[model samples]
Target: MERDVVCLVDGNKHLYDRGAYLWTLRPSIVNRIRRDYPKARNQDFICFEHLLPYQVEMIQSMMRSDEKQIDKLNRKLTRTMEDQEYRVTDVNETLKETQTFGQKIADRVAEIAGSWGFIIFYIIVLVGWIVINGLHVFGITFDPYPFILLNLFLSCIAALQAPVIMMSQNRAAYRDRMSSENDYHINLKTEEELRILHAKMDHLMQHQFDHNLEIQAMIFEILSEIRITQKK
Candidate 1:
């Protein structure tokens, strides 16, 4: 069997199957190689591996002209981004719905305990206890002058209230941590959206640049034709 054969711009020979090549028939590729490699100025073929500086950039520019090309950079970038999955979540709503009965009670207890209304009510109860005992209103005294029984009750109230308040505080800390995490998620999503927007902007700028170059080329061709007509 005979193998395919090819010649490079550098006057080198190789089996066609072993090397990738572009034809000089493409004026853009030929011009790009000529601009970069003076030795390949009039060559009829260019080897992929031996492409000189700016040659790859030229090929990329040509590839961008055709959107249907599978290896197009913009298509690959957008496709990869589209394939990624992200879920938008509301952490606050989720946390609220997942709260346990104990959590609700703890929060309510903490709110009431930390308020001025509860403070005033507590003071009134203490004052009433002392006045009733001092006046002997019921013709009996449960807590005498020193009010030792009242003191015990006060101690018991403090012992029980402290832990309840702490439980509420712990829940608040947990809420703060969750809020922070939610903020992080929001920031991350915003960053990703900005990146996608930036990518789109870059693609648009590249497309506009290519369009302008094509228009310039067309204008040059038109001017050359006009000059030739005028000379005749």
Candidate 2:
């Protein structure tokens, strides 16, 4: 029996760091992360939690394949990926349908910036005005006369900032949608490869069964020949 292992492949530093932190904490899961965060530099794909089965299989495959053969295979796969029919199908749509996770943080951040954060800031500003008028907060009030002017300013700022904050949320949602699509495509491709593997396995099993049956028939014919010779 062979054990499963995980490896990570990331193009973004922050995402890579996230993966490293998680894998280091629990050295059991091994998966590859593919990310292209423009802001994150110096972070590349990393292999993690190497297990026995994967190592053995890798070694076996490598031993069976020379560099030239491997290159040929890779090229073939790449060409297949570039086929017109495959290209026509939208990969993003498939990824959107299937993803590993939900973009909760993106949603929450957008939500806060759009609504809750504004509400809280507004409350704080209103309190500050009340304190100034009533000489509250240890008698260190700055704007002493109810501060109608400041109140007007705060309201104006809130009105403007609210829309801007809402824009940020909308942007986040777009990014979330894109990320979801990426994850879905990865899964879709994985399942496709699994199907190919399954087909190969089935063919191998059928071939072995047929070979065994042929061997059984051969043995029976040999025994019959022996018996006939003894009867003679």
The candidate that wins on lDDT is 1
lDDT of 2 by residue, 64-139 (tens): 4444444554565555555443333455565445433334444454566668777799789787678766766676
TM-score of candidate 2 on Cα atoms, chains taken together: 0.40
Tell me, by TM-score, which candidate is best.
Answer: 1
Candidate 1 at 125: error in angstroms? 0.4
TM-score of each: 0.61, 0.40
* Candidate 2 local Cα displacement, residue 40, angstroms: 77
For each candidate in turn, give its C-alpha RMSD to the true structure in angstroms. Answer: 11.1, 29.3
lDDT of each: 0.65, 0.48
Weakest ten-residue segment in model 1 by summed lDDT: 17-26
Candidate 2 yields a Cα-based lDDT of: 0.48
Deviation in Å, model 2, residue 8 alpha carbon = 66
